[model samples]
Target: MSSTANWSYTAQATIWRCLGRNEDGILTFDRPVVIKCDYGMNARKGSLDIGRECVIKNTIWTEYGKASVGDYLLIGKSSEADPISAGAEEIIHIQRFADTFERNADDYALFTGGD
Candidate 1:
């Protein structure tokens, strides 16, 4: 249940995992998933209505320190750019973003966010 090269889908999977759990440590996909946002998504409480030209990382507006989207601010020629770079981690900027946002094993942590 891990995604290596999928960003938006990975986020959606995160949403799924949030509401998924089963006896065998698997999520039972029995019905549609309902999500409530306490963070992230900009436009509405649980929606990110971005247009075709928006960058995801330039300015992710927040509410009380939590990110959210508002009205027509949803669309644009925006993009997500990561500026953190340590030595030996050049793979992130040059190799990753240049080639594409392909998340390697080290790109994530064992326990992400509150997981």
Candidate 2:
């Protein structure tokens, strides 16, 4: 997935916490994904979470290994996405794009407890 945020300070851009805080799902690809956030020098308000349904379509790469999710992966977004704390009772449901490895249109993941 790709994202952009414009902030003027080096603050907490995104706070990522797992859904179940218990399970780390599957690893499907070979190349690790890259989330390039071209924020301003002092951008203070921008962040994202790796909760679910995160499809990597571009050719970005890294020496680090790739990450993956299991069946029914999901993600949610807003004009604004952020790092937050939540309980496991509610899972994150994310949608997918055509380039995604999955033939379906959605992926979901759940995170519980909090950081």
Cα lDDT listed for each candidate: 0.20, 0.23
Candidate 1, residues 13-80: lDDT per residue as tens digits? Answer: 11111224478884332222222211242221221233222322222211111111121111122222
What are the runs in model 1 whose C-alpha is more than 4 Å off? 1-17, 28-61, 64-115
lDDT of predicted model 2: 0.23
Q: Model 1 reaches what TM-score against the true structure? A: 0.15
For model 2 the TM-score comes to 0.18
Model 2 stretches with alpha carbons more than 4 Å out: 1-34, 37-82, 85-91, 100-115
Q: State which candidate has the highest lDDT.
A: 2
- The whole-model C-alpha lDDT of candidate 1 against the native structure comes to 0.20
Q: What is the TM-score of each candidate against the true structure?
A: 0.15, 0.18
List, residue by residue over 9-55, the lDDT tens digit for candidate 2. 12221123233332365222222112322222221222236543332
